[model samples]
Target: MLIGGGHSHVAVLRRFGMRPMAGVRLTLISRQAETPYSGMLPGVIAGHYTRGEAHIDLRPLARFAGARTIVDEAVGLDPRARQVLFATRPPIGFDVLSINVGSTPDVSVPGAEGAVTPVKPIDRLLERWRAVEARLLASDSPCTVAVVGGGAGGVELLLAIEWRVRHQLAAAGRGAGHIRYGLFTDSAHVLPTHHARVRRAFARTLAERGITVHAGSAVVKVEPGCLHTADGRSHRVDEVFWTTQARAAAWLRDSGLSVDDRGFVRVGDTLESVSHPGIFAAGDVAAVDPHPRPKSGVFAVRQGRPLTENLRAALAGRARRGFRPQRRFLSLISTGDQHAVASRGPFALEGRWVWRWKDRIDRAFMRQYTELPPMRAAAPDAAPADEMAAPGQVPDASMRCGGCGSKVGASVLDRVLTRVKQPAAGRVVIGLDAADDAAVAEVPPGRLLVQTVDFFRELVSDPWVFGQIAASHALGDLHAMGARPATALAIVTVPYGIESKMEETLTHLLAGAVAVFDREGVVLAGGHTSEGAELALGFAVSGDVAPDGVLRKGGLRPGDCLILTKPLGTGTLFAADMRGRARGRWIDEAVASMLLSNGPAAAAFIAHGVSACTDVTGFGLAGHALEMARASGVGVELDLSALPLLPGADETLRQGLVSSLHSQNARAADAIANAARHAGDLRFAALFDPQTAGGLLAGVSCAGAEGCVAQLRAAGYPSAAIVGRVTPGEDGERWRLKIGD
Candidate 1:
């Protein structure tokens, strides 16, 4: 498993994707969906490169690698337990692990932590940059900005900021004369680590830009509107940017690894942790014990290949190779304009051509991951391990070819499906519906049986959580028909493992499902079990309802209010989760939302006089809602903004996260009015995100919509809200989905 979306880890994922090791499962857990390429950060600040150009999208990369990317940040590691603990969720087990989590800025100075923004964690820095730019644009009076480091990172950042501010002011018909910039460092000279010629060139450039260089004293403290230096002097500035030091994350030290004083993992020449076998470390978060090198992107980028090779070998118990660092490497330091300085082992040059060279080199490096080779679709919603399935063609490639692949240890269903007998004529109380979970029977005195089945490959690694979600999902059609759950038959798949291990896994998986079954007062009937390559579960459920009481999708009135009893974006968020790009909290919240039962929400709708209702599932809100609309012969206008969303759903959509089933779901966009007008909006894109075990989307009377929402919220669904209203379009205009943002 790869812990972090660092440069080396991306390389590892890409290589494995091209040549996957059969029977070896890989997983990547990261805090964010994208990892910034530090090489072009200055150019980004100077507006020379867009944010996309400066960051690597890990989602597609993980897909190409065929790796399950868990979007969670590591908090600690239990080497003995062979597990990595997350901030949320239970600890994930890994046979082998590698750490490439990059370092952050050492923002330890007084007031700096809260007031000043650091240059590291480029994502946050860019956000702060936007705020700074906005404040500058609105300020009528002169404003001062200070950078707290005089090293390469700080110097380059300061120059970039100055250039960007000046150009922005000029663009707005204002002047840069009112803006003041300062560079603070404890050192006596700028670019102290660079050669004399390089330092002189930057110094002259800074002087020309009218930026003050405060070299002798450091920024001892950062204040709200100024900075305090060590020399008993305070420099008043509107914004102070910290970029002085690179500090390793404290979590690494607590992970029980052999870390240096700065909390970075100490590694051998092979980039493997010195104290931990089968655990590797790379990038700024690792300190090489054989030959310690300063924290720089140069070393990090070069470590990728060696780290990948060594990790593969170590995992397979092969002899590992060592990485030899280059004594001197070329450095292309941009001048914040269309020019740069190149330095290597006392040799230096400067010009616009140098900047072009740097841009080419950076883009070329990014292209390795950005312009990746085509990979098979890694659909998160594809029948994971046979927990659930849909009839006919699977748009997702992952679910295809499940003939023999679908079979388990024995011919469990052959006897039942193939064994046919002559019908007992009128006495045949129940007719055979082999496809249905349970057959409908002719009962006396107005009675009917409702049967439904649900299964899908497991989404989460936790079997227990998967069990609950799968069982809850089995009630989708039953709840849609306003039927009460009665009994269920489970079909489970366990990976080929030891007898004890298999039993334990099955126990946890069934226990979780049974607990939920008991809550809904459903019985656990006999089911089938088999061994497979991965963990999966499925359930065939039967519920009961009156013949005339079955809620049909066609029951809708023009004036009915549409109520959505949950948020959207599970499909996209989980898709993002598989790319290791979704936030942990976002996944956690999405899981919690999925576990929510629509039984209560459906009851609430029925109590308030339901018109038409259906639980949103794999087809997504737009697809399922359109189904309801078409079935009811009505038009619907959804207030795009009013559609309740899970936390980070909008952000994930904006970040370009869409599920494998998104294309299929989005195929229904034609049913939407003004689709093109809102195509660029992230909220509109969410309409295509597939949901699993999602909330109930119901059409109810306008008079009862408010009270229905209140009852649903009070019943534990705070996210439930009235999203749209039914319209009068059954035939001529067809079904229409109007979006209001």
Candidate 2:
């Protein structure tokens, strides 16, 4: 599993993509889908590079490497068990692990964390930068901005913000005279680590740009609108950006690995953790023990190739290779207005041509990730479009919809619901076409009512796919309780756009949902719709169950075998998808499984006379299984390896990708009996992998467990597996799991 989408990890992914090991599977876990190239960040702020131009999209890179992309943050590590813990998911096990999570900026000064924005984790910093830009453009009054630190980063960012603001004003026929820019440093001179000549060049440039240089002024504290220096000077400003000291994630210090006082992982010359074999650290997060270096993107970039080779060798049980960074390297720092300064040791030069050289190198580096070999299947024919509205013609949501007129247009609703004909069952005495406020249902003499409601914001980028998954997921509740689905009431919220486009999108979505409804023989009664910020869908589904026959979670008995009807890992995969970290094929496969109804699986369980069941959803397998185990007053001995998994799940888990709900689900670890003993096994991570329209988890009689699994496979659930068995439990027994025992 590869953690962090930092420079070295990207190199590792690209190499692994080009050449695959016969039996090795790779997973890339990243906190963000796109990592901003540190080299181009200043250029981006200066408005020379667009967001796309400056970012490396780890999604395609991970896919190209045949790796599963998981978007999440690593929280801690258990070296003895070989498992990496996350803030929001179950611990991920790995035979080998590498971290390149990069360093965060220090915000240690009182109120600094809240008052001033730090610079590393460039994605968030970029977001704040845009807001500052907008505020500057929107304001009629003058503003002052301060950048703390005399380092190269502080200097470049200050200049870039100034340059971009000036150009924007000039473009709008306004001059930049209204804005004041300042740079404060604790040291006597800026570019504290660079050649004297280079510092002189920037000092001259800042003076020329009319920027105030606050030399030897250390910012000791920050307030909402200003900062105070250690010398007792208070500088009031509209915005304060802190870039003084580099800091590492606290999780590193907590991760049972050797780390420097700053919390950066301590590593050997080879970049492997000095104390933990099979686990490696790189980029700013890794502090070389013998030869420590200041954190720089250039050094991280240089580490990529060697990191890849060493990782491959270690994975294949070969001798590791040594990669020592050069003692000196070229530095081309942009001055924010298309000019740059070049420094090599004591030699330094400044010119526009230097900027061009730097730009060429940066763009060339970006191309490696952006220009990937396409892998999607042949494109389908385009859907016919209604004439699009001209720019700015899309209606503002607030302008419409306080009354009945705000509802979806009757004609459009009619067109969309034409496919949702009522089922021929007598349970529906009055249906959708009747146009009543609500539909009437008849409960059979021996049946009890079961109702469930579910709704969510769109997951997939595609509307049709989103609709299908929503509908299927809503019905999963009934399937878990062994109820026969009967009808549904849909509540939809569609974004305000061109009338024709909105209608078309809604039609596709409803059609997709109706297809599933038709298969399950469920009728779409009626519901409401409204204009909203984004498209969202939900359902209040009603099903039937015989009171005596209903499957409650508390029905499990000792000696019953546990059967999981489908695979795990939908949560992390979808979370990755939301960030564009997951691959298309991975999503396609997940959707296919999601759309595969739990109807048949429910029936298979019912046929085997099993009453203990629950569908694994956002809480993950471990969570739902624990629910069943605890409620039934029994313990579950899960054979971790026997659990079925969706394609890319294990890979994504290894890469540290997990859903936002992963942490909550992982909390169920308190219920696992033997987790710590075998927590390092990568397969165990699947337990906390959340599912969308996931499979059924049930306890069947030991005598019928194998037969029930056979029946489920015969019913089209080929991935179904007998994963565990219910065991005796004392009120206070400790472990409830036996993973890879």
Candidate 3:
């Protein structure tokens, strides 16, 4: 599995998707659904391109690669166990793992937290840009902007913001000089990392734009609306953008891998982690080679080929090849507007045409991902008998079976478990074994058995990722009941395939499932399997909860706050996935959200006196909410605007795309109190989009609702929100659901 959808990994995914290695399953894990390429970001800011044009569509890429993309942060790593742990979901197991999580600006500088905004993690920078634009548009007075750091990123951002703001001002019938731009650098010149000739060109460009250049002035501290320099001088500013000292993500330091002082993963020429051979690091997160190289996107881009080769070699149990990175590369710096400066060693060129060249190069790079090659039919010699089997004997590619009919073969399941080292405990009675039909466990007296089963087909193509989401989905039921999962017996169905392919699929799928089970203190006991035409997975999980600790679905009382742990919309995106229309990033986001188990949310809910809860799954939010309402004997009033949606879901719905189960889900809307009153709202229509491994919808007491929501958000469930409220039921019959504006 590939972790972090940064620029370099994107290239690797494109290459692998175009022509995948047989017996290898590719999976990508990222924190964001859409990964913005830095090369086109300045143009986006300068209004040369729209967001869609500049941003890569990760969903299609994932589809093309036949990879499952998970959108979540990797919080920890167990190289010894070959498992990657996420903050809110199950651990992911990988035979060969690669990291391309790009660097972020150093935010550890004194007063840096609130005084200045860092421009790395392009998404946050874009958000800050929007806020700055709003402030500028809201005022008639002049605005001052300061960019700290003399590097290319800082210079480019400063110029881009200047050009965009000025053009916008002129269009508004205002003076172009209404905004002031300043560049601060510790070095004696701007573009300090580049050649002298390149620096001179940028220096001249800054002067021409009437921008103030403060060289040899390191920002020691940042104050409200101002920067304090080491020279003991302060520069007043309306906003401060920090693009200095790019560093690795802090999580990497604690990941138990060998890292340099700067916290970047230490790798040899082979790009394999010096400490962990099974794990590899690349892109900005890696410290490369025989000679130290500056952190640049160029190196990351170049490393894609070698990284892919090494991963394949490692998986095949073959010797890995070393990657000899080039010592120097050409640099292209944008000067806002449609102008750029190019540097190759000592030679420097600046003009509008240079920008055009840069644009062409960047677009060419993006095209590698956006435009994919068509899948070719197998050659006559390579085609298997099954491919040419008679009509009655051959399985249809479409219209897959549901339920237990779609499971992995028993033989394949047996082989995968041979690799896993089960934890040994006398008390841990239930565990994976060859002869057991059902997991047998010895529960202590006074502990009640909490049993729940959840199953679903592959919403995504990647088996490893499907495994994670399936595990998380199944565990949600246990979590909602405030139970500690003890053991799980997996039920997996893999598509009919050759022995090699079947083994590979089962390995990744079980690895993913087992990773989650391990983290939740659940043991993987034996379960049944069979061959099928499609991939599906589930777990029969048993948990333990104190007699009084069980939270039931019918205990919800009137005046309770309804809190949703994660956003919705996996079903719609996956529906789009079948048509090859969903963007890679969109699918990535959906998978990430689904893979997030409701464990944390459930824990928080129980701690805050949650009365009742249920996970939103195959049923749409409205359908699930109705179930809660019916069970609790109460009425629910949901604020449409308060609903949290997965990114890109609204666009998919606007495009008239929906899951296959949507119609059935929509039929359940009959239970909604005002279904006809606001039938025209597109947002309301999305209430019927079936979610996969969705969030926990809980009804908590009003007294602790605010604090519970806050705690959930701080726990990395940023989309967690109080979506609705529980009210007294009208009659003896179950309940009602209302959509409020």
User: What's model 1's overall lDDT?
Assistant: 0.79
RMSD of each: 10.1, 25.9, 8.5
The candidate that wins on TM-score is 1
Q: Per-residue CA lDDT of candidate 1, range 1-741, in tens?
A: 899998888888888887776545678888876789998999998999999888887766776777765666788898878788866344666767888888888999888887988887788899999899888877868899889888889889989999998898889898988889999988888888888999999999999999999988888877789798899899899888888878888877887889998889999999988998888889899999988887888888889889878877976679999888987889899889989999887999999999999999999999998777655565332323222123332223343345455444333233322222122232123433233444333433465778888778878765667878888888767888898887677788776543334554565567667767767766555466776666789899877788877888788789899999989989888877676566555777888888888889889988999989888888888888788888988888788888888998898888887888999888888888778898887878888888888888999999989999999999999999988888887455558787865
Candidate 3, residues 1-741: lDDT per residue as tens digits?
788987778877877766667656577888776788888888888889887777777766766666766766888888877787876444667768999988988868688886777887788888899899878876877778999888888899889988888888888888766678889999999887788889888888899998999999998887677788989998888898889888888778887899998899999998999988878888889997464788888888888988888887887778999878877788889999899999888788989999999999999988887776753443111223244234555455455455675555456566677755456442356556534555678776898889988777766665767788788888888887888888787776766655545666777777778778777877877666666656788888888889998877777889999999888778777777665577866776777787776788888998898899888878888998898888877888888888888887888888888888898989977877778988877778778888777888899998899999999998778899999988886664349888875
> After aligning candidate 3 to the native by TM-score, how far in Å is the CA of 123 from where it should be?
0.7
Clashing pairs in 2: 17-65, 70-657, 88-662, 88-663, 89-662, 89-663, 673-735, 673-736
User: Against the true structure, candidate 2 has what lDDT?
Assistant: 0.81
Candidate 1 off by > 4 Å: 376-453, 459-492, 497-530, 538-554, 561-610, 618-691, 701-741
Of 1 and 2, the candidate ahead on lDDT is 2
